[model samples]
Target chain A: MEAKLLLQDHIAKTASITDEQFDYVYSHFKPLFFKKGQTIIISGDKVDCEYFVVSGCLKAFFINDEIKMYILQFAMPTWWTSDYSALYNQTKATINIDCITDAEVLCLSNDDREKLCKEFHQVEHFFRWRTNKGYIASQKRLLSFMNNNVKIRYEELLALYPQLYNLVPKHLIAAYLGVSRETLSRLYASH
Target chain B: MEAKLLLQDHIAKTASITDEQFDYVYSHFKPLFFKKGQTIIISGDKVDCEYFVVSGCLKAFFINDEIKMYILQFAMPTWWTSDYSALYNQTKATINIDCITDAEVLCLSNDDREKLCKEFHQVEHFFRWRTNKGYIASQKRLLSFMNNNVKIRYEELLALYPQLYNLVPKHLIAAYLGVSRETLSRLYASH
Candidate 1:
């Protein structure tokens, strides 16, 4: 699908926007492509834009003091990803985002997003709806982590992103679940 | 401060609304009081409204199958809490919210919120900004959890909610940090 149509469809799900309005909103987005493993945002760099995935996948992740990488989110097609904390707070990124596979994304600057939202009530509604969903997903993930039931977490993750099994590397999946590679293998075998 | 003023000030920080608009927006909220330990939402009950804390604190939490509680959020004055997934999706609550101390809250039903957002662009912007902050905080908490740095998590928690030390019980604090009471005591002593 074209980036324009994909974004239009995604936005249409939450907000009612005419073609003219969507075109004006979409004009602010710059389409960009990344090769697999290409970094989008690096820790300590200033974050200015958030990417709306048009094709392929990207991972927003963190590496703690021990150098162990933890996957915070996998941005699949039509999904948005960024170091949002950094973007909103106007601070340096504390997390990194990179492509999981060669990907195409529509990049929207923070300023333009605010401008569009201010200009269009529907755009504001669309973003509020988007953030609400993100907040819910994050809350759900937190509960899943605290539950400490690996089997259930594994099941929930797969249910939420069924294509992940084949699309994402096993090690990355393990990191997302905070499980050992061996443990992930066991879950995979049982399934 | 009164509930209306408190909520109005919070909104003003992110949005510009005329006094008439603010009052009209505020009219939909139903103020309710809860005694300490009073439950607001229970697992399996349908959630309809989200609460904005006017005074006192509330805990939004979940209990796993084994019956261990994990505090997802501590809703302080000016903060919002609900089983948002259930409230937004119109599903049964998977979490519970209760007063940690005697509390006053302004409840806005999902219908009212959507109606207000549709009617007021500033209200939509205010909510989008609010949810963006919530989403960021939740993501940061998830990172702190995955980092497994208990000391950092403890510091961050206290920094974020300095009043919580005097207001909330030690056990609940421990649950929020995902630590044992003994560890919490050690953190307290170290502080």
Candidate 2:
């Protein structure tokens, strides 16, 4: 299926919009291709775009004083990725996003996305619902961290996104799961 | 100021609505009163209402198997509180919200809020903007938890909500900061 079709499918699940409206929505975000290991965005760079991952993988991380990168998001096919704080604030990003695999992603600049949102209520509605989903997921994640054991968390993660193992690197996945890579490996081997 | 004026102020922050539209928005939520230490919504109960605090404080928490309650939100005046998972799914709540002070809140049901969103695009816009604020705050918090020392985090907490110290119990404030009471008291004394 085409990336535009997939984007439309995702939008349709949340709100109804006509083909003409969808076309307008599609126009706001341009397609950007990247080779594996390419940095799409870096810390202190001005954020001009939010990428919609049509295929392949992108990882966003921040390096702390310990010189370790803490992964914040891993974008796979059908996921959206960006330095959201920078995207919203129009400031330099403290985090960096890199293509971890050769990727084709739909990109939308801040101004164009805002224009699209203002142009059509459908577009705004779609984004509103998307934000809702992200909010609930993140809240549930914090709750999981506070309450669930590692094994239980792993089970819940699997139940929520079955394809995560195949799409993401194990260590990166482990980091996202808030567990050490060794523990993740042991868990995988044991199960 | 009256509750209606506060509603206008809240909506006016993002978008302007006509008097009629404001009235329509206002009709969805009924005014409610809560005493300190009152349990507004318990886990496993049908969460039919989302409260908007006009004054005072409220906290949301989940009780673990060890019976430890982990605080989620410490809502002050002008804040919105809801068990959103249940609000979206119409299921029993997974978290309990309790008033931490005598509070006057406006309660809106999921159905009414949905209808308002569908009928009034302006209302949708307001909520979209509100949700985005929550999203940005959460991202900052997640990063802070990973990188910031407890003292620094405590300082940031106070900087963000200075009134919290006098308005709420130190222990509850500590819980919201994701620290212990002793730690917070020490930080408070040192600072």
What is each candidate's DockQ, to 2 decimals? 0.94, 0.61
DockQ for candidate 2: 0.61
User: Could you tell me how far off, in angstroms, the CA of residue A83 lies in candidate 1 after the best superposition?
Assistant: 0.4
Local accuracy of candidate 2 as per-residue lDDT tens digits, A62-162:
88887766677677787888888888988899898998789999998888877877777877788888888777766777777667478877888777768
| Per-residue accuracy of model 1 over B20-58 as CA lDDT, tens digit each | 999899999999999999999999999999999999999
Best candidate according to lDDT: 1
CAPRI classification of candidate 1: high
- Lowest lDDT sum, 10 consecutive residues, model 2 chain B, at B140-149
TM for every model, in the order presented, reads 0.99, 0.95
Q: A1-191, model 1: which lDDT tens digit per residue?
A: 99999999999999999999998999999999899999999999999999999999999999889889999999999899999999999999999999999999999999999999989999999999999999999999999999989999999999989999899999999999998999999999998
What would the TM-score be for candidate 1 when compared with the true structure?
0.99
